[model samples]
Target chain A: MPHLAVNNLRAKYGALEVLKGVSFSIEKGQVVALVGPSGSGKSTVLRTLVGLTPVTGGNVTIHDDKIDYASSGSLRRARDQMAIVFQQYNLFQNMRIIDNVTVAPVKIKKRPKDEARADAERLLAMVGLADKLNAFPDQLSGGQQQRVAIARALALHPEILLLDEVTSALDPELVNEVLDSIRQLAKDGMTMILVSHEMAFVREVADKVVFMDGGSVVEEGLPEVLFDAPKTDRAREFFGKILRH
Target chain B: MERILEQIPRFFTADNMALLLQSAGLTLAMTVAGCVIGFGLAFVLVYLRQTPGRWALPLRVICVAYVEVFRRIPFIVVIYLVLFFIQTVASNASLFTIAVISICIYAIAYTAEIIRGGLESVPLTQMEAARAMNFGRLRTLVTITLPQAWPVILPPAIAFAVSFIKDTALVSQIGVFELTFRGKELNNQGYSGILVFGTIAMCYFLMSFPLSMLGQYLEKRLATPRSEQSARKIRRT
Candidate 1:
């Protein structure tokens, strides 16, 4: 069975529908990149998975544990196995870097402070933020903050990590550092579904590429197959427009 | 100026000074109790406003109504109503009890609004981030939302506290014999109104000035950069 599967997911903001019937699945240790034009419901797909956006109709399953989107208990249980890092890096401005990474483990998982602290230190070290343990989010550059956000997500020991345009907000120069940390995670065999605009990085890191438009999956295949050879005209057009710029 | 200075000593006669001290204590007691208790009520109001599900709709409506009614109506009017109404129904209730209840009701409304503003100022992503990490609702509020909102909440909360101390003066209308009421009594007993009222004003200033300064101090302390705070700690070590 696929490690994570989202089927016929339907979500809306209000009167406007964003995700009509989006579907995708990822195997264990697989890295899938979701690329699409703006408002293609790429980020919303991640939000719905994490329970930040409510799914009107859908079924999300992890390792044969199925959750109907309408049920709160199922959503909560499914979300525990998953974590998301947002584009803006959304670090708690009130906490130090160490505290930011440790808070979820200690507060949610009921881990001891010392144990959580050690884990946070290890995760921060992984992201190259070990020296800045006491620094505030505001003190770090945009890229460093995003790395801390990644370490924070990792501290939860999530089986699946979701990246919602994680590097879109960075400077052109700073993007690589954040991407490199993600590359390290991929090397470690972490399962991730990333929504990104960085086409080159997506092509390099993703095992599978899913192209979406108008709130539905247009075409998806292996990166080389999808990027190099287009099966659908919509995919061909999207690649044509985005690759030119 | 000479007359006012002379009256200061007269006001400090052992009996008069005792009464002044007693009234000062009562005023401080009521304000502190009101503030602390009202803060509890405000917490409930804020939670009710944020709760989800069907019951939350009515709870939110009730919270909005409670805030609007208590905030829009004058505290003095509320005190008068509580004082006279309680007298008719429960003659044995102490005036002090009635006074504290009245002040708390008024303070709860304003405090709830200030707290709500603080909560709203916190970015929605903070809650999302906490929830994404599997933190439950109450845990998210306590651990993530509240801590972030606290710095924003403090200044307004303390400003309200200072104003709360002043608002206690309104309770004097119910004959509670707190500082302002006692000041009036002293004035009626043949001291110049200027001397008597001015002294009370100074006492209010003494209480409020420190509170305002404490608010300033807390804001600065909390605002200190974490890096600097850690660096300072390291230097001391």
Candidate 2:
């Protein structure tokens, strides 16, 4: 069994079915990039993995333990194993950078405050935010804030990290810094699932690239196989439009 | 006009001025006490788990009804009801205590509504981010939610405090010697009702004007930053 598996995942918002029987599996230490156009339910898949969005019908098994959405207690237990970095960089604006990174470890993990603070300092240093420990989210640039957010996600020591269009909200100049941090994490053997529009970053970092369209997976293969040569006409057309830019 | 000038000395007599000072003290005491209790209860009302099935719901409903009922009736009537009617039923209650209790209850209702509006104005995203950090619900509310909400809530809260002080005059109807009562007493004693009332209005203006200015200062201070601090830091580097 893979480290994370989504078997026949179905999700709906009110009456509209956004994800229809989507199935995929990711092995441990594999960096899989889910690439698709807008409204392809790519972000929704990451959300469902964390139980942020209610999964209508699906089996999301993380390391052999299935997430039970009906039971919040069980879902919370399952969620502790993974971390998610949002496109919006949802860093707590009211908290200082160190506090934002340390909060979950201290509160949820019940780690000592001193230990959590020390861990946070190390994580911030890792993300090139060593001097921004006392700064608030609003006090940081978009790149710095996203770096802080990535550090916050890593502080949990999660088995799998979900990146939902992490660099889409950033300026063109700032995108490389965030992508560099992610590439470093991948080099350190962290299993990551990214939903991003940065095709160049996707080509460089992802071991396997999965193309999703209209709430279902259209194609999945190694980046070389998928990017350099197209098996399907839909994949070829989609790749042509995005690669030209 | 000359005779009235002689009467001004009598108006400022030691005993009369002492009574006026005492009234001012009592009014301040009542207003401050009411504000603290009212705001405290209102905080709970706004954030406490009072949904239909929660244990807090009944208490919340009771609190809501209490506020609505007291808020609708005039303050004078509420004071009168507490002093005369409640006193008749539960004798041995101190009149001073009754007056203070009535004002606090009235203040809670209005303050709760103001606080509820402030609480609602806080984006749900703030709370969700706090939750993602795994902070307990109560911790999230106090440290994350309340701090941000306070700057928004403070102006209206101060405005309510000023209004509460003005409303203290209504308690004089139940025989509390607030500023208005002193003015009324002076008027009855041939001190010229216009001059006495004018002085009373001046006293209120003195108290309320400073607070209104403070509210404006706070509102300006709490205005969301226009220049992005993050972008500025990046430019400096």
Best candidate (score: DockQ) = 1
Question: What's model 2's lDDT at A160?
Answer: 91
> Which residue pairs clash in candidate 2?
A140-B230
Clash pairs (backbone) in predicted model 1: none
lDDT scores of the candidates, listed in order: 0.90, 0.83
| Candidate No. with top lDDT | 1
* Per-residue lDDT value at A115 in model 2: 91
Q: TM-score for each prediction?
A: 0.94, 0.88
**Candidate 1 structure quality by residue, lDDT tens digits, A45-83:** 999998888888877889978876567788778877999
Q: After superposition, which runs of candidate 1 have C-alpha atoms over 4 Å from their true positions?
A: B1-10, B223-237
Taking the candidates in order, what DockQ does each have? 0.70, 0.33
Q: What is the TM-score of chain B in candidate 1?
A: 0.93
